[model samples]
Target chain A: MTETEQRAGTRPIRVLIGKPGLDGHDRGAKIVARALRDAGMEVIYTGLHQTPEEIVEAALQEDVDVVGLSILSGAHLTLVPAVIDLLQAQNMGDVVVVVGGIIPEEDAEELKKLGVKAVFGPGTETDEIVRFTRASVGRA
Target chain B: MSLGQEILRGDRRALARALTLVESDPHAADDIIAEVYPHTGHGIVVGVTGAPGVGKSTLVDRLAGQFLARGRKVGILAVDPSSPFTGGALLGDRVRMEGRGSDVFMRSLATRGHLGGLARATPRAIQLLQAFGKDLILLETVGAGQSEVDIMGFADTTIVVVVPGLGDDVQAFKAGILEIGDIFVVNKSDRPGADQTMRELRQMLHLGPQRTWLPPVLSAQAQQEIGVAEIADAILRHSEVRLTDPEQRQRRMQEAERLVRDALADQLVRGVVSRSQADGRWNEVLAEVAERRLDPAGAARALHLEQD
Candidate 1:
């Protein structure tokens, strides 16, 4: 086992990076998935155009610690909170939901109000995302 | 109450956390397991293994759905090999079970580059799920490999899924998988040569060693959900019969013993192997062994795993 694994009660932190919209863009999600993986977290990436229900269902099935929603198609407000509502409905309120991609400042604050943990808008560094994720979920 | 107590009380988050802990630090998870083991042994552990593309996932999904329809809870632990370069995995097995509601708790675990965890943590995962009140747990292996037989240790019933027309008669009856399968299933049975494949399997079972269970050969067209209930019944039958069988207990105990022994040995030598790699001693030793210039056993003994 690695040193981190040697720690009692520590498992590899699991993150689900998903895109929940009709927008076919997925580069942001894939990039963030790679970053999380490089940071030694287990990442499950859902490819383009996933329904909020499918995404939330996957989160429950995978038992992910955090979910990163990638939305570039101006649907963050509707799609992001819809995922949050579904997660909450399934008693998965503890799962930290994050967002990345193009979003207006107003929408990012609205997402925060909707219980998104953190948001990475345009020109954010991958390392920043990794660090924030590690800090948010803590070790494992 | 302890985490184990929470798990026994059917706390979903606690169960998920336990699986995560087991995947990363199995040695540590042993402590929690010791606390909760008495609450276990109720649920049936089913092992599903086969070569890739054998429809193991699809069959398992449908099988789990059947259990759900009966108001029984099911858990699935899907194992996939981690990428050597990235140490990350794309666990796509959950895709098949995506819409299947919350009654089924499924998680995908990377093999983490060890043949041992498939044998070790798999049982522990099943135990945790069992304690969480699951009626059945399906453990799907990482395709199939020589070590995949280790799944038999944890499962009360092991279903080896095979598809027709993969190859000729000789290729189909490779002794490695044939020997360990508790139940041989010819999946995609609606296709051509399905009966012929079943016939070959029966012949192989006849030629192979006889055991307490004759290892029933069955068929399933998983896509259409045909013959699933019979397979489910077969699983239940095997699990029920094996409960009181001392031989089954002995086999499981022996498997547990080997896993502990191997895990300790691996931990002991892992640092030494890393040091050898860093110091350029690994390849040199391998080359010497390959050339017969150095006795592999002697070389292993000479380089102490722990430098005293």
Candidate 2:
């Protein structure tokens, strides 16, 4: 029997990894998505160029345990807050939100102040991100 | 308000949570489903299946758009396979879907190592959508193989998509898939050998025993939305026949009976195994079987006898 079949009758954690704005570089996003999937989390990848509204809409509809935003467009301040606001406004304040991609240290702190769960900058280990996500969603 | 009541009242978040509960904690979902069961059977459920890269998701996207244009509230359940090693899944169907809007509800499901090209909770998810007042529910299966025919039990209409150059007419003779399709679509028909593919599908479909509904073999380039309207029309036609056909009631009842029997068998096995394990009899029997003191059949019989 497969590993999953051995644990039949249980559900795995679900995550949505999305890239918002006009950023077309999805290599980082795809890498993280694969890492999460390999770690046993179902990851919904909403490819590039998504608006904040679209990201939150997908998060709500999918009812994911975590929303991992991979933003490299340098628009994290505007887009991240927009997504968080939409999510909270839509009554999804409990969904854990994480950010990845290129972000300065100061902005990362700023995002945490805005309720972003964690910010993953360049050279961050995928395993570290995975572990952090699991703990954030209470699955670790 | 109760979650079931909220779902019935058309609260999107409530419905989403209920669906998550259905997938994650089915035991908890039982009460909710019982509460909403009477309101189900109102929505039309369509199942789309095919081999990998056959454009099942793309076609579903187009079909959802068609239904939306017709003013229908649509719910989509897209199933992908979970990794056998880690149980994780990359459900990327929404990437190809541009038709989802405020009125369209889409959720991705991992098969979670369950076979038959669908997640275990798919039927319950469909029930929830029906209770939420969706006019149509689209179920897109993980790339189906020849024997993944479970979708037949749940969907009102089943569309099997295929692309050319996969195989020839002999491939269609493979029993299970051909038997379950209510409609066959040759997606990516713009590619070479399209006519041959369609002709083979039509011929194979004809070879089946004649029934109330003759499954139509249609061609489509699903990416550009070509022939999608005709596919919608075919689904409508099939639905109409099913609604009016006298035998459909008997078919549905038979399906229900099968589902109940399967569930009962599952519960019986689980209950017996858990009880045996708790009492140490299961491990005792396992050791006996491992040492060759008792054969597997004898151990199984002993377990069953112990249950009494």
Where model 2 places Cα greater than 4 Å from the true spot, the runs are A1-6, B167-169
Q: What is the C-alpha lDDT profile of model 2 across B1-308, one tens digit per residue?
A: 89999999999899889988888756679899999989998758999998889999999999999998988889999999999888899999999988355678999998876789898889899989999999799999998558779999889999999888886656754898888899999889989988998888888778789888899989999899999999999988999899899997898899789868876886787787888878989889989999999999999889989889
Per-residue lDDT over B207-254 for candidate 1, one digit per residue giving the tens place of the 0 to 100 score: 877777788999998878998988988887887678767786787778
Across residues A7-50, which tens digit of lDDT does each residue of candidate 1 receive?
32245678888878888878777778877787767787766778
Q: Count the backbone clashes (under 3 Å) in each candidate.
A: 0, 0
- Ten residues in sequence with the least summed lDDT for candidate 1 chain B: B112-121
CA lDDT, candidate 2, residue A72:
88
Instruction: Write candidate 2's Cα lDDT for A1-140 as tens digits.
Output: 22333466566788999989988999999999999999988999998888888888899888998999988889999999999999999989999999998999999999999999999998999999999988888873
Tell me the deviation in Å of residue B277 in model 2: 2.9
Positional deviation of residue B43's Cα in model 2 after best superposition, in angstroms = 2.7
Write out the backbone clash pairs for model 2. Answer: none
Q: What share of the true interface contacts does candidate 2 keep?
A: 0.76
Report the Cα RMSD per candidate: 5.3, 2.1
